[model samples]
Target: MPVLVAVVLVVAGCAAAATRLRVAAPVLLVVVGALAGLVPGVPLVEVEPDWVLLGVLPPLLYSAAVAMPATSFRRELRTISGLSVTLVVVSSLLLGLFFSAALGLDLGWAVALGAIVSPTDAVATAIARRAGVPARVLTLLEGESLLNDATALVLLRSAVAGAGAAVSVGAVALDFVLAVAFAVVIGVVVGRTMLAVRARVADPTVTTLLSFTVPFLAALPAEAVDASGLVAAVVAGLVTGHRAPRVLTPRDRVSDALSWRTVELALEGAVFLVMGLQLEALVVDVRAQHGSLHLVLGVAAVGLALTVAVRAAYVVLLLRSARRRVRHSAERSAWLDEVEQRVERRVQHLPADGDTRAVRRVERFRARVRQARHDLDYVLDERLGPREGVVIVWAGMRGAISLAAAQTLPASTPDRPVLVLVAFTLAGGSLLLQGLTLPALARRLARPATADDRASRTRARMHALLDEVAAREGQDAPRVQVLRAQRTALLDALEEGALDPDAVGHALDVLDAEESGLELRGEGLRTS
Candidate 1:
């Protein structure tokens, strides 16, 4: 425990530095663990399934889910679900079938492994948000990462059991359905109860505890009943988050925001750090070694190649299909070539005096404004209610679990157990490697080519703020010129993607109507 604590402290320090360097925290955690392992007496951090599948996953999922705008789910339910659910099942089967054929693992065992690996990655997808990726891609990847794990896990358990004995196809199918349904139903019921309890509590700390306990309560009961613990945890979290805004006061939200972020940071660090330590255990048992390390590496290489090939093919198909559909819907989306051409048009607009820095900030806010607009339209066009709850639920990807599961190998298997370990290592690596990197790659590939009305948006908000202040304090709102000056400064900061919507909203609030030289007797003055 002391050694682990020491390592964690060192890792926490490194993670802080890595954040400044713009490196992913998981990447840093893994590095720290690797270094810690080199010390002769540095012990490993041992984790039971209870710690991993139960303890860690729920809080992480909750923190991520709470921030997911429920409205987005209502709007993009079909597209999001298709990517999260259908894609997960398809990818899992492909990975499983490939492993079965290439590694000589039976179809069942291979499928089990595939199911385990299929989920995108909750941690990676969540982390990608900070990397300047578009919200739509983050929505799909993060949501899929959260939900796909349970789907994969349930399928894997079914596949493994069926692979061994007289289990029927009916049996596996029943297990899969029951696992999901039971967990969802249980989670919903428990989640509603928790929300009710929280609505009655005014204390922030107590309410936060209520939030923390909801997932575990939902998960444990579901697992105890042979249902999906993970699914239950996720659903419970989504429900709590879905209800939080309405039921809890702003103080509650503030408390949650702080607590959740701390939990998120610590838990995420622990996850990758622990992974590095425990993955060290999936090694050779000298007495009954399965196969040559070289052979395992070979299978892993094939598996990695297959994953990349499948993913690339899937993306091409997805992009093509989406483009064809987009052409019919909006009439103006750029073709791939056009999008590239747009970069040229945009580049020419760059200030020749090397003010790329200023241009870049303007460009970023324009991008955010575009996305904010897209998300807003989605909220409008889609009929999102509780049933439209697909966003938070579907956003459940499982990268960390898959990595942790890789560490759970029995250290020995079929005289060629090395093959299994190698396959897992390869698959896990691809998941970490691709999952961590793909959003960035995807953002680069398909970032929209057009810009939007940041200047106008800034002006409009400033006007609104000014009008409100004039009403409140009986003073004229700030002048249009002053607001414009403030906006110029704000846009400069926002261009580098440093602006928060709330901060922007607050900027709007700073413009008092009374302060802007407009006044009326018990009536607000409108901005010019």
Candidate 2:
């Protein structure tokens, strides 16, 4: 218990130091852990793979998914899937072949090592976020990191199983499909059921408690059925986040955010610290096993180079595609406008007392056309170019997840210690190489002045919206009522794609604060 307390203290202290120094906390924590491990009396910390995979990962992913704007996630789904799924598969396979030839290892074991290192860490993307990378780039990075784990882990499991027996490509593919399908089902059920329960509960404390159980509730059942628990947690989080605004009270939402942010910090900090501390022991283990430390380091370096090269190539293609889409946006917009006009004409022809079902269908079709046009406009406004592409490529740093996944390898697997060391070195090297340089790169590739101008305009619009709501609600309406109306307006703007999600989020925060203040004042008056 004392050791645990000390670990927490160390993590908190390092986080504070990082904030003060304007450094990435994960990078700082790892460095601190490594230096502290070298102390004469510090005990060797060995983290069980289960501790990280089962305990730490689910909540971290869940929190991130909840915070991810549903609209952005949907907007970037195609790009996100390409990175998280296709890129991972390609990187893992290519790296596996390279490792096999370079190290003379078995194909299955080599592929397992490849899978371990393929997924980028979301925690590391905090560096990119702090560096002021554009929102679309951050969305891509965050979404990739959030969803890629399932792909990598499933590949890892297949590789490990193949090592002992003949596991066919068909079988592996089937496994992945079933895992995702089952996890999605489990996640949706758990997410909706828990939201229903939480909505009925009056106490914010109880609501928060139920919220805490959500990730695990989604994960545990998925894992029980040999599915991807992390994916289940992510899906549950997305559902909760998308639905919470309508179902949960503002206080409940605020409480969940505050509590989950704290949990993310502590858990993420511990993972990195433990990652650093374990490096010394891993080194010792490889040495004890008569493996050349230098050889493992070389392999890790080569592996890192391979992954980076693949990512660069993939991102270049993505950028080219984005440029093409932007180039042709005017044509697409015109076409969409024509389609919308036709729909409007059709709506005009429909009788007011026409068949209700036919009218509803047409209305839905018209809404879809409008939404498509809005989405296209959003794409044009935030087009990615070479600079954004560079940021995306460079920010693909590996961290705790690689090390944790590596540690999960079977004990009897060939060169297990060596493989673990390679993963550790790769993660450490990536963090130092990429995380350290990302901020400078971001500054160089900074978004244009127009981006800031757009943001300012959005903020002005938000204020205008609030004033309009106030005027409509009337001066005699309660302050809380006015705040609620403002929040509803902000949400409406967000849905219509008329406001930036970040701007809407800030406006919502202001409304929540104002409402809370009014409630407090009312309580004071009643008491007096």
RMSD of each: 13.1, 2.5
Candidate 1 C-alpha lDDT tens digits along 124-230: 55455564444455565656656767776777667667666667768877887888899999989988898898878867789887777877889889999999888
- Kindly list the per-residue Cα lDDT of model 2 for residues 315-391, writing each as its tens digit: 99999889888878867898888898888899899998999999989977876776687788888888898899999
TM-score of each: 0.72, 0.96
Error of 2 at 342 (Å): 2.7
Instruction: Point out where model 1 deviates above 4 Å.
Output: 168-170, 286-291, 324-398, 406-420, 435-528
TM-score: model 2 vs. ground truth: 0.96
Which lDDT values do the candidates have, in the order given?
A: 0.61, 0.88
lDDT of 1: 0.61
